[model samples]
Target: METLTNDKATLEVQLSTQQKLIANMREELGICKEHKAMAESQSESRGAHLLELKAQLEDAVLSLEAAERRMHDGELMRRRLHNTIQELKGNIRVFCRVRPMSSLEQVGADPDIQPALDFPPSDDLLSAGIILSAPSRDGAATLSKHVFAFDRVFTPEASQDAVFEEISELVQSALDGHKVCIFAYGQTGSGKTFTMLGSEEQPGMIPRSMRQIFESSQGLRQQGWELSLQASMLEIYNEEYKDLLSSKKLSGSNKSTKEGFGSQQPSGEIKKHQVVHNPDGSTTVSELTVVDITQASQVDLLLAQAMEKRSVGCTALNEQSSRSHMVFTLRLEGVNEAKGKRVSGVLNLIDLAGSERVKDSGAAGLRMKEAQAINTSLSALGDVIVALGNKQPHIPFRNSKLTYLLQPCLGGDAKTLMFVNVAPNIQFAGESLCSLRFAAKVNACEINHRKKG
Candidate 1:
């Protein structure tokens, strides 16, 4: 009986101890669950913060990209503005172009006779400064060399595309509301025509310029500009303006008409229109044909028609030679809706008659008269260029009709470029030198811009 009671007491003590241990284990489990919940809550908070930070970082990157683009655009705008200002200052640029030797000129040449012309070394392989060789009177083999510098020079090897690249910026200036004049001054058969009006395979300045203007207009439409272009073609023969796009003229390569003897009248009773210099410093002729040009093809057609009407006569130098100066003018007028401003720009592309000596040209009769007129006008032009270079108080703009009409171009607000073409034939060295000297004088003339509207 005593042993059974002791065993029951021991069992009771063991049960109490086991209960205490169970209570302690439950408390510890509760604390661990609480800590786990708190840890999960903190992890959720950190995940949300990371998402916010990621979004902020992405926004910052986008902002940086936008800023970079804006900065780039600003830089471009700055360059454009700088160019516009330079052009507005009436900086007359000059470029010289040398035609390659023709097969005819190279048919029979002295093997011992060296080339009279040399070009200086230049960074641009396409262009080089001109160096002319003059034979000394002593008859020594050593030739006198004359070197001339120009704004740019194009060798015979230069492509039309390459030549256009140098002047494309000038075309852009015309679109930017500045008057731009580009004329070729050279002897006959010096590739002036080829450079100005290249063939279908290789278009020259007029075609290239027209194409660029039209294309640029399309792009500028986005900038709130509505542009309208008008064109007119005319010939200055015997100091008279003959409408090239006139309906009265027939289309042929060689047509000679005896012009009437008068200051402005030719053989035909073509109306002698009076050229009025506008108060705004622009030239306008009475009874002139101005055609609206909408597309590049229209320009092509107008040019073709003008060429057909141009007075060309066969000469010893050139079979299809320009007897009269042909001037093709483009007037660009635009309205900028954003700025509420009106912009007017004039682009004059001139192909002057070849400056040839009457004796060398083998001209007689009407051809002689034409040659005399060409020489007279060109002399007057040279005089005008000289006066401009000297900054003479009195420029003889009224000395000849050619000078009168080109007053705006010669020494005024117009941005003018004279392309002096030279034939590489050693036989024509004298005439080529004359042309270069004239170009050098013209290059030295500084023109100032008038206030633009």
Candidate 2:
């Protein structure tokens, strides 16, 4: 009976335990439903937040692009403004010097030239000799009251510094890739040559200018200046252009060959009728002296050779008409070692043949022809200068060989300077006035400066 009671109690305990477990399971199911709902709500919030973040990122990207665009535009505008300022710069610089007069026979002489001081060397180079020293111990006295006294006394060896300063600035422009020009003017026997090309022993502007460039280049080597140089020389004779330094052909070339007229396209460019082409497909150009000179001595050699081959003949008005215009050009093709790009600049040293009176020259035949050509070309040059000064619509650069050759100086990107040589002689009064007027006009011309290869 006792065993039956114990078994009944055990069955009751098992049934209570099962009922507690069912209760606990029901509460857990309700809690799970609440958790699921909260999870759905959080997901929706997260999706909205994600969309906002994407929008912000897109706005940031757009802002960055806009900033870059603005930066590029500002750079472009700044470049334009800088170029405009350079364009407004004027080119004309005129300096007048009344020359001191001394008989060519009285002053220090031309070293490389001799025999006849007034005449150029005949096939015999020494036949024409130069005056060695001042005849009078008081050289200044001979120079003071002489007709050219104003030029000689007022103008000194130091005067070229001013000119070099101007040209030096031009060179800086060229180093930045600008073109430049320098021209000298005076009446026949007025010392234009002296100002442009000093004595052989004491070379003038051209040589000195070249030296300055070389020295400056060396100093600026660290700044990245790489230079390439070329030189060309030509003359306007009898309305005909001649290459004074071109090697003569012993077999086929003759006087006609030297006399042949053709326009020179110096270097390759978009040259039109302004520069004529050679029919031979070759020019006096092929005969050019192309040398790379690192040392100043190398340049000296070239100047010496050029002087010997120079077309110098004696005339009544002056010893040498410069029979040909000698243009000693320095083409500096520099690559900024710093910039890693190329730049080009040119220095033109022009010693123009002074205007002369045929009556004064007492020339004949070929000489007469040279005189007429010189006079005619000079007249045309004067007319062109007047037109340029007036800013007239038409500038007759092609009117004369001299003027035409100078198109680059007057019409192109160049810093131009003209030296007006005057004489103390009362006979030269008219010449002085004309030269001054021409200088004033040249100073007025506005040239277009543009960078080209």
Candidate 3:
């Protein structure tokens, strides 16, 4: 019986050991199920967080698109506002500039010369009016005071930068897609050329305008605008138009072959270049050479080339006189591809031949003919301006090549600014008076309406 009891005890021990192992295995399986449940919950939370992040990303994308649209709209508004400001100032404006007398002119000069020209001391009248004193024709001792008013008047002390500051706004208008014309009008020694084409140290309007256009175009690129510029230079000499940038030579002419002024050949052969007016108010000359202006430096080279070929001669009134009206045109074409918009603008910078009398200029033969031609064209220009001012039905644009070529800029919705240069000397008092009077008339004349390009 004791042996049987011991055997039972051994079997009981083996059963208990097996039962303990089973319990341990069941407990381990329960722990695994809890871990699996936690893992599933974590996966669900992670999926929910991913969806939230996706929604936020979608919102950000939409916001970016909206901002871009608003930016585009703002740019359009800016252009409109900018143009409006320019129009309010004036569609056509005139500024008078008096050049300081050179040391040579001042040397041995008459002491009474100081009374010839005077600028008002008051700031209110300083830029608005100029007083000119000249001996009356009736009596040498009797002085006549002629007071003139204009849009703006620059004194002899005004620097090139100061002059350009007033003109920078108009230059900006050209980039905003408007036809702009800035021309200098005065006598030979009145500093018209100097004001328009200043030295390297003191750059003038053309260079400053080009540099502004280029710099502005780069800034406009951020607003989705791409601008391209084309430049053309021409000279109107002896009632005929010559391409200053032309490579052709005048056959059988005594003039330098390098100079491209198309004079009549010995065989009576004449090259005719027609000025065609486009429906878009842009003028084109047949056989005119157009250069792509990629940089401002290119325009400098062109100006140098034109100056070399330009017709200039010495006279008693002034040495190195400009015998031709040089017209430099810059065509601006802008495209906003994203907005499906396009703009075309033109800027005409003209340096007109000085206006002087034959007696004063002391011209004979060829020089006399050139002086007559210059005077005739200038007369034609004056006639056109008067007609426009009077609102005449038929403007005399076709009277001269200079007038006809500038028809688009002078009339219609184009922006025009005239710089009436003057010489601050007693000798040029009469010419200065005439110029100031003409400019005053121009400033008083108002255009009917304007439409931006």
Candidate 4:
């Protein structure tokens, strides 16, 4: 009986051990399945993200290809559009602004650009709604804004309060129906962009201008006047233009410029995209962005996009040089509060490319070619000024990429203001003179305002 009892106990212990082994296997299997599911989910998510990145890359490539086409074939398109451009001439007003002078030694070798002869110094600037500078404790930080109207021809280092406030008035004038053009022109290292569109850390004329527009619009509205606004943002890179406001997938194969003037290219570093003009006298510029905003944030959003997609390239003078021209145009179509009639106006904020000597640029191969193209375009711009000054029957506006692209603004019915930026360096004196001379000529360009018949 004792032996039988022992056998039964042994059998029971073996069965119990077998059951424990099965349970362990089941738990292990479950864990493996759960882990496998999680791994698969992660893999799928990664795959989607990769696909999105691929799409973005493809779009960028297409834009690049389109840019290449414009650089090579732009001349052809320009010839085709030449007739249409001549047929329609918009109002363009040129205001030449010379940055106040700063000493080369004190400014650590910057440039000083002179304003044109249009402004003559007078003690009674208050009549122009201008404020002259009173000495401040902060030395010469900068004109916080273009607040003063000076025929005095001060350097950029003179008065911040005067500079910004004057520019603000210029902005107000544009919104008030005078075609306005404001620009920054100077040497390669001059503060051309700084005076017009300051660094990311600092906001220059454009921001200041926008603030004034909003404020002006607000004031107008408070007086029971309403306005409709349209904004277009674009950038010219390597002679090829691109729309900074586009969220769509744009590839060279599927992209095109306005009026079929630009088609896709196979390859290139900088591409040209055509400016898309809105029907309300505002042009969206490219597939990039064309928004009509009654609010300030919308404008800021557009500016952010344009700044992001600016033509930045590696350079010796500026770590990231603006590879092309950047233009932000705002069209304000509003009712005349006093007249109770419809009015139209356009304000173009142009940041022209700084002039860089090819040899000094220190670029190689492709970069060298790019620099050459930029220099050539700028030279042609100079040629245009010379022609306009000569009052020649044929102003070679189509001589270079910059001039051709600027036909609408420079030659159009737009009030134009130019802020010639300077670096205040002795070495840049020659370039400064060149810039001042150009501003003087631009100031002389004729503005034909459309007369209501």
Judging by TM-score against the true structure, name the best candidate. 3
- Per-residue accuracy of model 3 over 318-368 as CA lDDT, tens digit each: 889999999998888899998899988888999999988788789999989
lDDT of 1 by residue, 196-299 (tens): 88889999899999999999998668655799888877899877878787666422221222110112223354456567676776676765666778899898
Q: TM-score for all predictions?
A: 0.74, 0.59, 0.85, 0.57
Q: How much is the lDDT of residue 57 in candidate 2?
A: 89
Q: Per-residue lDDT of 1-453 in model 4, one digit per residue for the tens?
A: 999999999999999998999899999999999999999999999999999999999999999778755653663464335423322321222333345444534556333533222233455622121222222337563332224232225444444445677566556656666446666666566666766666555667777777778887876664445787766656666777667665543443333433212344443233445554456444333333456667776766677767787767776656767777777767777774643556566777778787676555677877676677777777787677556545578889766655665555554434444565544443444454556555555544444432211
lDDT score for candidate 4 against the true structure: 0.58
Instruction: Give candidates' CA RMSD values in order.
Output: 11.2, 14.6, 6.1, 21.4
Error of 1 at 278 (Å): 1.5
lDDT for each candidate structure: 0.77, 0.56, 0.82, 0.58
Strongest candidate by lDDT: 3
lDDT score, candidate 1, position 407: 76
For residues 123-173, write the lDDT of model 2, one tens digit per residue. 431111111121233644231121111111233233655545545655555
Give candidate 1 misplaced runs (Cα > 4 Å): 1-90, 109-111, 122-128, 134-143, 249-269, 448-453
What lDDT does model 2 reach?
A: 0.56
